[model samples]
Target chain A: LKALNGDRRRWDIAKLIYMNNISPNDCIKRWKGEDVDEDHESEIEEEEEDFFQKRNGTASNEKDAHEGDLETFKPYFETLDRLMQKWKKTDLLKDRFIGKPAFSNEDDA
Target chain B: MAPLVFQGSENFRLRLILATLAGKPIRIENIRSNALDPGLKDYHVSFLRLLEAVTNGSKMEISYTGTTVIYTPGIIIGGSHSHKCPNSKPVGYFVEPLLYLAPFSKKKFSIVFKGITASHNDAGIEAIKWGMMPIMEKFGVRECALHTLKRGSPPNGGGEVHLIVDTLLAQPITIHELERPKIMAIKGVSYSTRVSPSMVNRTIDGARKVLRNIGCEVDITADVWRGENSGNSPGWGITLVSQGQRGWCTFSEVIGDAGEVPEEIGMKAAYSLLEEISNSAVLGRPQLPLAIVFMVIGKEDIGRLRISRAQIDERFIQLLRDIKTVFGIEAFLKDVDDPDSDDFIVTIKGVGFTNTSKKIA
Candidate 1:
């Protein structure tokens, strides 16, 4: 996708997945600015931020006594393969690498 | 050939390596041009010096201010050589790029790199040796070995690594593996240098606790180094390798921050390994770029690999652009229609590149 305009700028990807009931392909298209439906586009809830931090293991000040070291496990899956399959099905993964040219060259070359 | 012109200091190593391999001169301008320092970093300069040492007839010129670099490519004349890698970067930093050039050199490549051996910034020494080596072997370049003589931590760093890559390939075998392999076992090494031996065990305990629930046979060795081989700094780290029956390997490493507890490092590493497995990558993230580069310049045939969408990040796209610019080839990408897989099969026809430095006698 080409460069997106100002109005359709950066949407918090993790929030998009957890909050909305959207197809993976459509979510990706929306992320790339191919879809601009305004109905489902809601401001991210502040309380849900803590919930996301718990699931994704972001910087959470407080931790569970026993499971603090471990990442949030999907309680429904009994086997590791089953859990992996669940992850693959949900397709919650994001391309996490930085795409911007490191050390930008904005000046005349 | 016209000199390939690029901007910025990012991907400094790959650009130089590709230029050397293709025997095309390159001119890089506006390197960190608007920054406060506004020039190439010391490690970049050191890498350039390393290129000069291993290759013959290479010419490099830097503008007086050091923002622009003009490099004329040369033939790789491999031999027994040693380089003092600056402590700013780990030996893994130099070793990864060097692997691409080793088999293509005139002679059996042997190089001694001394510097910080283990760090969080890049893949550590063990990851390259245990994790990436098998991937290289699949492409049919054998007889590559790494012997870590000393383990060095960062800051006040003093560590040493010896690398030997002898066997050469007529061409890398065309590879295609689309199915994500099932991991059968997990093995790792938890090593400490100049630190209390008990710390290693604690780390192992933490990792084992998490791995226990995964229902796999896990084996981890605790290596405690004493005196000289431990290097000048006190540090510890762990390297974990998980593999399936299909030769698919994934690696995770964590270096202990100074005065940090070993248990945290172990937990961190275990979590990282789990993340890699669940990421839907057929090949681990770090090795994908290396494989792509090799395939792009390999035998004149289409090579295909199945990888997940999450695997295609920004650096990967940039690499594709660079590859197109340098080799005039594009990767044919098609979405996988499999019900079970969220992946794309990448197809590319090789440029039939051969090692000009290694003339057939």
Candidate 2:
């Protein structure tokens, strides 16, 4: 458990921990015995976004081990939501209005 | 009849999953066709063998180059079966996908998955036990159990997991839950194999230190394996699963590395669990794919689900797109009414695909 010069070793070599998900980005500040506040938590959120950044240029989305990335997805998801609402409500309603009515206008009937 | 054709090795598992569930044949081309070691990997081969064992007459044809595959799915005739999982991937890799097929099997699904229990790339057994189970229960799965019979580490893998699902759902219920429930309890598993038992205590202490601030009750169990049950390697790890009142559950775990101390593993898992709890949706990130499947296959009525915006990563998007292609079902995504929360409500209409192979009661 001792590091060089009789100092206590930190997290194995500490390098592997940094390389993995235990980085401060995943909220390790709390584990480090550091004071954590809302501001620090918000900062961690931004770092996490960077951690899950977009890699859309490479490989098919369905490929093994290549789940979708983090950045860019929020915007893409927003656009999709808007388009779905437009098509499901506006276009479908318009298409139905254009087609023959289930019952002709009551007065005409 | 022409079979569904797909390109590349993407969604390899999903394609197989959909094909089996839909009783349709699928042909996949150009799997890792451009890579240096272009072709199906060892895990892929082992997974395919496991699939065949779990079902009846699932035929698979691989080209001499291993870049193309044609799989004719068979009915799930699940029963007692055992397979040796490749060390390249953990048991969770094979078992996660298999659970999707279990509820539709002819008999109660019973399988023994022997391999490295924990790995960097896959969910550990504890996640499936505490986290995945509750999610399945929300969709009307009656009784299922995941037992970690042995602990194994990578390279010299020799772990075993016995999974049993005694009940089947005629059809998964339509779940339209939107509220982000409150977490009431956090249960955890800290384990060691062929290592000093002190490692487990150290891990629990480190985890408890971080979790002490939370208002909920935190209980972490320490598991130790003896003799042959310890598997072939020495390692330690921790998996923390959180439970909310309304069937919302999630898990985070960390496996000890070659030089990593037990305390670090505990702290890592605790921190990750905090990250997961921050996205307090009805399902955890790992549970999203499973929810998608049953939501699409359940009753024809629309099922609405709420998920944090953080969970809207590429894999989730691609899975939705794939469902649109294969099942011809689209999910209606929209912002939740609560402006304070960054959650999206996904509304999907299930296809009402019931298990035809199941025997009549």
Candidate 3:
């Protein structure tokens, strides 16, 4: 705690409070000898635990990794779908004039 | 056998036909030093007259020596079957090493050549006319004339005279053979939605899929722009192809670092892409004419104004000219200028494997 106070960085401070489920101000007040409820820390920990569980259901580490993969690919697929949808209209017109594609060989210079 | 008549000296005509079949006009690499001046004029007149008759469009050529004047018509649009001379003497030789057509077939074309020996009775002013014998037989105009000019004195003397008259009896050449996939006979259409560089590849992919769905064989390379620096990155370009035909359509959005280029500027780039393809075929190399749209959502007030001006610039006119010069392609542009449009459409018509051709080494 003393090391954290000495560092005094915004993101690091937020990380310490949020990860530990404690209010930095309350910690500071207690450090300065102000009276604080012992139950308040326990409540904060419960809130943090509830927040994490709600956000990421109870899944094994491997399952979590697979879910991460799905989450990552979702945006890519969305972009591709959007692109395809955008092209659909013009593609219809292209079909009207260009007609069916004919067989062509791979040899090209 | 129908007799064919050649109206002029034969040697000159043979050279001309040989040159044309070789895909180039005959070059007078080096005239034999001892060759007489009289012979030159005779060759020139005969060559010019035959060309005039064949082309049906007239041309006039004056030799440096005041003694020679040659006239010719322009190039004929189709092949013909006609003869210059039928039968005369054996002063000159006509060699048909591989006459593909049988002698008696309707396709049979006969050539009669005559050579003139100054003193020999067997060879008087040789002339040969190549023609379709059956056609000549129908008209009964078989015999040809070989004019041998007598030798004269200096100021006019010391030059041997040779005149060549060639006639070809050819039928109109039909476009019978399939266009042998000359210079990228491939064809397809690509539709694009955005002006962003990534959309360029997207458009190509869209095009390829459409082609594939329609049963076209497609060969696609890996996405050109790959990895973290992919989207919104500057200077992205790709080569997309359905077949041998290649296209390079790229657009870059310069963000914070360079700031947003005015919308008109983006439009200018898009318009230039069209111009390049349209003019490419005329300048050389076949290009698939395309309809392209520059889609942009305006960020700043200035960007919109800039884009509006670019949409109707002289560059567009030049682009149209290039398209016309190729297989008559016209590109229609669509944009926000006319709203209620789902997407901007650049409609392309008659864009296929058309090209400006030149012989390559």
Instruction: Give the B-chain TM-score of model 1.
Output: 0.97
Judge candidate 2 at residue B341 and give its lDDT: 57
Q: Give the DockQ-based CAPRI class for model 1.
A: incorrect
By DockQ, the best candidate is 1
- How do all the candidates rank in terms of TM-score, highest first? 1, 2, 3
Compose the digit string of candidate 1's lDDT tens values, residues B1-361: 6699977776688888888878889999998888899888788889899989999999999998899999998998879999898888888888888888887888888999999988766768888898888788878877899888988887666888998999876567788876666676788999888889998999998777656545456789998988988888888889888876567787788878887778867866776777776664667777777788888888899998888766654345556667776787788766566655557788889989888876792
Give per-model CA RMSD: 12.3, 18.2, 34.0
What is each predicted model's overall lDDT from 0 to 1? Answer: 0.73, 0.72, 0.26
Q: What is the lDDT of residue B201 in candidate 2?
A: 96
Best by TM-score: 1
True contacts kept of 2: 0.02
Of 1 and 2, which scores higher on DockQ? Answer: 1
Greater lDDT among 2 and 3 belongs to: 2
Supply candidate 3's per-residue lDDT for B79: 29
For model 2, report the TM-score of its A chain.
0.19
Error of 1 at B328 (Å): 1.0
Q: Whose TM-score is higher: candidate 1's or candidate 3's?
A: 1
Q: DockQ of each model against the real complex?
A: 0.03, 0.02, 0.02
Candidate 3 lDDT over B1-361, as tens digits, reads 1112111222233333322222223333222324464334433444354444434344454445423334332334222333232122222212111111111112222333222221111111211111112112222223322322222111111212333222222211111111111112223222111134444444445334433433333343322323321222232122222221112111111111123232322222222222222222111111111111010101111111111211322223333332332223344433333332222223343222111111221
Off by over 4 Å in 1: A1-109
Worst 10 residues of 1 chain B by lDDT: B312-321
